[model samples]
Target: MELIFLGTGAGIPSPERNVTAVALALNEERGTFWLFDCGEATQHQIMRSPLKLSRLEYIFITHLHGDHIYGLPGLLSSRSYHGGTTPLTIFGPAGLARFIETSLQVSGSHLDYELRIEELQEGVIFEDEQFTISCARLEHRIDSYGYRIVEHDLPGRLDRDRLIADGILPGPIYQQIKLSKEPIAYEGRLLDPKRYVGPDIPGRKLAILGDTRPAPNALQLAQTVDVLVHEATFAEAEAELARRYYHTTTRQAAEIAAQAGAGELILTHFSSRYNREDLAWLIQEASRYHKPVYAAYDGYQHPIPRK
Candidate 1:
């Protein structure tokens, strides 16, 4: 899985960055990508990146803030001109359905694909065989939410080399050995599948949070996750301003990641006030509290490897 940052600036767009939009590319795992918070000009950003609008399967909106959702109607409309025929589902806080419906209605825009809008509640919103997505309320000015995505554990690989060494040549029996829960008769002998399989591979966990101040739920959502994507809207020197604005500072984001035991922390949603040159200082402040912390810029890509 990989995270592609289409836009990373906070509130408004700047020459160096756009607004907040992130694409979670799962082409290898699921054959499609999920979007988090489509901000203003997000489609424009996607056009510049390697992502395709036709492959967008899910969209999770953190809040109804204009910077977080202004591009939704336009992107949805444009997807029709592309090859987006598959059904699309959008999960977000209350009032999202009205916004999208009103925008499409007023603009006389129509989509060729099925569009499903689900107003989010603070719990597990989606669950299938492969993954489970849960949300928790965040401490933002609006009813913002943070999402926790947990990929289901995968079955262990068959020890093909060991089987070959044991003179069990590759055949239909190998498939039978891997699928059998109990011992299967293999060449007049019972063989246990567990003995030929490796340990179960652990699933990857990711927590992508919306703009907010430090909250307990944030730590719970991000606990022991492979990656924690949080917002650092201000520098540590502007801690008071951050609190007043219901946003987090660089140091505060790192502290949360460290406290949550996250493997890595990626900070985004930077204020336009800080230009490209000031990012190094922000990373320095965050690194004092946590190792392997990154401040994401527009078009930045971070890969999450399987454990």
Candidate 2:
């Protein structure tokens, strides 16, 4: 899977960064992409990348803040125009449904595809055979959520060479032996699937958090994640200001990653005041506690590997 950061600024757009939006491309895993947030002009950013809006299957809004969700109506309408006929589901706080529906209604917009908006709570929001998504409350100015996306363990490759060596030819019998629950007869010999199948391969985990201060839920959701995307809206010198504004400082975000034992950390949602050159100190401060910490930029792609 790959993570594409569409916008990485906080509150407002800047020359270096836009706002909060991330695309988790699951084309290989599920043949689709899942968006984390849709800030203003997010569709414009997607246009500049290799991502396709038609592959979007889910949109998980962190909160109802303007910086986090202003592009929902426009993106939704544009998706229909772009020939996206599959049903799309959105998960967010209680007010998200009203905001999107009201915006679409006021603009007299009509979509050709079905749109499903769900008000989220602190629990598992979605699950399929491939992945499971769960949410937890975060400490922010308004009600916010952090999402944990866990991929299911995949079965290992079948030993075709071993089966062939054991007087078994490649045919429908191989399919039956692999899928059957009980012992299968192959040329008057019973074969067990356990002997031919390799061990189960572990999947990857990712944690994406919304605008928030330091909280235990953040660490819990990010535990042992392959990548932890957290908001670091202020530098260490602005700790007081960050606390007053209900945002996290560079040091606090790093602390969360270190405590959670995350494999890697990508910091985003930077304040507009800090330019690209000014972001080095933030990364330095965060890296003091955790190694391999990175500051995200718009259009940056981070590919995650299975653990």
Report the C-alpha lDDT of model 2 over 1-307, residue by residue, as the tens digit. 9999999999999988998999999888889899999999999998999888888999999988999999899999999888899999999999998999999999999998999999998989999998999999999989999999999987666899998898787898777766655788777788888788777678899999999999999999999998999999999989999999999999999999999999899999999999989778889999998978989999899999775
Which residue pairs of candidate 1 clash? none
lDDT of 2: 0.92
- For candidate 2, the per-residue lDDT at 89 reads 97
Give the CA lDDT, 0 to 100, for residue 224 in model 2. 94
List the global CA lDDT of all models. Answer: 0.95, 0.92
Top candidate by lDDT: 1
The alpha-carbon lDDT assigned to residue 221 of candidate 2 equals 99
Steric clash count of candidate 1? 0
